[model samples]
Target: MVGCDDQMERLLEDLTQYSGSSRERKFIRIIGMRGIGKTTLAKKVYNKADIRSHFDFRAWAIASSQHNVKKILISLLRSPKGDTFYIEDEADLADMVQKSLKGKRYLIVLDDIWSTKAWDDMRLCFSSENNGSRILLTTYNSEVACSVGTENLSL
Candidate 1:
C-alpha cells in the first residue's frame, strides 16, 4: 500500500473493464523481486469494496516453487465455500474447479508463482467464454510473466 496508488488504480481499471466483447480471459501479472510489496498490493486490490462486488466469486491461491497442482486446485475450490472434501486425482480436481467456475464471473489471485509451468497447469481450470473472469498472478520471474502474454508490474 506504500507508493502503490498509481499501480493499484491501473490494475483496478484493468480488472473492472468489460470483457464481454471477447472470449479470451484476462490476466494481470505483478512482477517484482523478493521483499517488495507485490503480494501486498494484490491483496489490497483483491479485497477492495468495488472489486469484491464486481465479481460473482473470488479466490486466492498461493503457488510455491513445488507447484502441486492438486493442492492448488483444492485451495482454490475451497475458497468460495468452506467445503472440505478429498479428491485424490488431479483431473477430478481440475474438473471440480472448472465446474464451480464455469458460468460465474470470478476473480482469482494466484500468488507467488515460480514458473510458467505452474501457470500453464492452473490455466487449464479456467474457461474463456466471455465471462469477464480474470486471473491475477504475482511472480518474480520475467519469463513466466512473458509466457502468459501480459505486461507485468516490476517492483
Candidate 2:
C-alpha cells in the first residue's frame, strides 16, 4: 500500500459513505492484473479495525478458478459452532445465508472472483435492504469488474 495509500483511502470512504434509500446492496470492485496488489488492497480494506467495527457481520470467501457457489454460501453462513445446518443443498445454504444477514449490515469480501456467473449465483444470498451493507469484490478481469459494480478501484 505504499504507493496506493490514496487508493485505499478512496475505497474506505466509498465503503463508509451513505447510499440514499438505494435498497439494492452496493458493490465495490477492486480490479487489476494478476500479481498486482488487487487482492492485497482488498484485504487491507477488509481487515481495517474501523471497517470491521462498521459492519454487523463480515465474511471473506475466495472465488477460485474452480468456483463453487455452494462452497461460497457455506463460507458466508458459518457460525461460531460451525455449520449449524450441515446440508448439501445449495438453495438451503443460500437461504441460510440470506436469513443470517437479513437485517444486519454486513461486509462480504468475495476475493479473486473470476466471472459474472460466479457473482450472479452468490448475489442471491444477499438482501436488498437499505441498511448500508456492502460487498467488496476483487477480480483481474475488467469486464467482470465493470459488470458487477459501478464503484471500483483499478490497481
> Against the hidden true structure, what lDDT does model 2 obtain?
0.84
Q: Report backbone clashes per prediction.
A: 0, 0
Q: What is candidate 1's lDDT per residue for 1-155, written digit by digit as tens?
A: 66888999888987888655763568888989987999999999999999999999899999979989988998999987878769899999999999989888999999999998999999889887787888999999888899877546667
Strongest candidate by TM-score: 1
Instruction: State residue 23's C-alpha deviation in candidate 1, in Å.
Output: 6.6
In model 2, where do residues sit more than 4 Å from their true spots? 19-24, 79-85
| lDDT over C-alpha atoms for residue 72 of model 2 | 85
lDDT score of model 1? 0.87
Candidate that would win on lDDT? 1
Per-model TM values vs. the true structure: 0.94, 0.91
CA lDDT of each prediction against the hidden true structure: 0.87, 0.84
In candidate 1, which residue pairs clash? none
